[model samples]
Target: MKVEKNISLLPYNTFGIDAKADLFIEYYSLDELRQVLKEHKGERILHIGQGSNLLFTRDFNGIILHSGMARARFLDDETVEAQNGLRLDDLIAQLTDMCYCGMEKLSLIPGEVGASAVQNVGAYGVEAKDVILRVNTLDVETLEERVFTNEECRFGYRDSAFKHELKGKYIVTSVVYRVKPGDATKTREEIIETRNGKLPKIGEVGSAGSFFMNPFVPEEQANALLAQYPDMPHFETPQGVKIPAAWLIEQCGWKGKTLGGAQVWPKQALVIVNANHATAEDIIALAAHISQSVKEKFNITIIPEVNYI
Candidate 1:
């Protein structure tokens, strides 16, 4: 278990943020991770998957463990197991090739399978929790291996028990997904149509996906907004009516707005992209500014979906 010191973290994160870690270790297997943990017992450890959803605020003093054990295998006709480091897009591609259908809705979401379960990542009316059968995790307190069923995961909108009650208490090792065969041509067409209509074209530019989760407000609040702006779009969720954060941001005239090297994507207000040499601070500040503007103008607060480390 070799550990590097004072490692630059810029290459690790998707935002291309410049940050450092005092101690960094990349694990290729579960045994390697256990050995490292044994050697550095009682030390603070941050588990990082692909670094897509993370924003590093400053240099970390403790160890940053990068899970590089990228392995994916089909368990059965309807089940696939993937290591924590397996990229979400890779998994989607594999499923697509196999004619599997459930993951198509999340085709372009960045990050690893482990992080998807952590946040119950969702898009286009589908969520990770919907297909996850079980999650393999290493308990931090006892160092015991356990499998958590979907129900045990306690999934919610852009939230899971892993993000709150069990924040750093467990290290997810792998995820098991239940999928079924589908018509490949039809699925491909659907994906193409959705992308063409709702998202930026491939290779267009920079982004960490959607910047904020659509804020769920009371029906009354939504109706009041509808009264003022009758064409405002909203969708009903299990919680309440979810007003698109992008629509609200667009209404605030933030789309195509640039701040330093960061810019609200011209194509999607829900996305704040790094247009040039943008730093983590710059992106964060722009998001805050947008949030503040929306809150002050519409009396609603927009919460970021991206995780800050």
Candidate 2:
């Protein structure tokens, strides 16, 4: 266990907000994590992986626990297990290079392996839930270990039991994934090229990827919007029709719109970039502005996918 005081969180979070945590601790193994839980029994803790899907609204007044485990091993020819702290993209690269086929579409998504399960991160029709075999975790309060089957996670669109019924109750330690054997190098290259075209380069702009979940509305409501705008794009889900937030934001004329130092990414309206050292307040204000506009125009509520701290 390594504990630091009053740590600057700018490099830790993808948003690049310079928020400070009252205390920051990192552990490398499950045993160490158990010790941490035992020691900081009553301290408020925010457990994170890479902090890619998080936005710090203000300096955190509690301890922030992170994992430093990146070791991985194969259970078999088709099954691989990785510690929670491994960068998600790094794991993907290794799998693809070894000719694994299942993770190609999800390549380059910013986050760590543990977050992949927590958020059910997805892209190009593949979600982490699809390939996950098992999740290993420890109860925060009891420091007891439990293994959750994939079905137990109860993954939904950008959500899982971890974000709801089980929120703050467990710390994910590692994950096991079942993958197929085949080369996907070409697919990975194409995905990288496409992402580069749509998203800002990592060092160039700071963002939390897509800012909002595509709002799902009933068929009738979706039809009404399509009646108004014939060219709008949508997809059908089991629950309802999902509307593209970018299309709605663009229609509202918010593309490239600025609030303080935040701007809607010109290339992708769904992303809010730190255009000029934007504070967390700036991003929050801009997000509110965008949400309000979309509501007024389409009568739908688009909620943020990013976890605000």
Candidate RMSDs in order: 2.1, 0.9
Q: Write the per-residue lDDT of candidate 2 for residues 1-309, one digit (tens) a residue.
A: 789999999878888899999999999888899888888888889998888889999999988999999977899998999889998889999999888889888999988898999999999999999999999989998889899999999999999999998999988889999899998999999998999899977767889999999888999998988898889899999979988889999999999999999999999999999999999999999999999989998888999999999
Q: Quote the lDDT for 156 in model 2.
A: 93
Clashes found in each candidate (C-alpha, N, C closer than 3 A)? 0, 1
Query: How does model 2 score by TM-score?
Result: 0.98
For residues 1-309, write the lDDT of model 1, one tens digit per residue: 557999998777777777999999988888888888777788989998777778787888899997887788989988999999888878888778877878888876778888989989887678999999999998877778999999999999988899988888899999999888885546555765776675544335456678888898999998998999999998987799989999999999999999988999887899888788788788999999999999998899989988887
300 Cα displacement, candidate 1 (Å): 0.8
**Candidate 1 residue runs with Cα over 4 Å from true position:** 189-206
The lDDT, on a scale of 0 to 1, for candidate 1 is 0.85
Best by lDDT: 2
Error (Å) of candidate 1 at residue 165 is: 0.9
Q: What is the lDDT of residue 239 in candidate 1?
A: 95
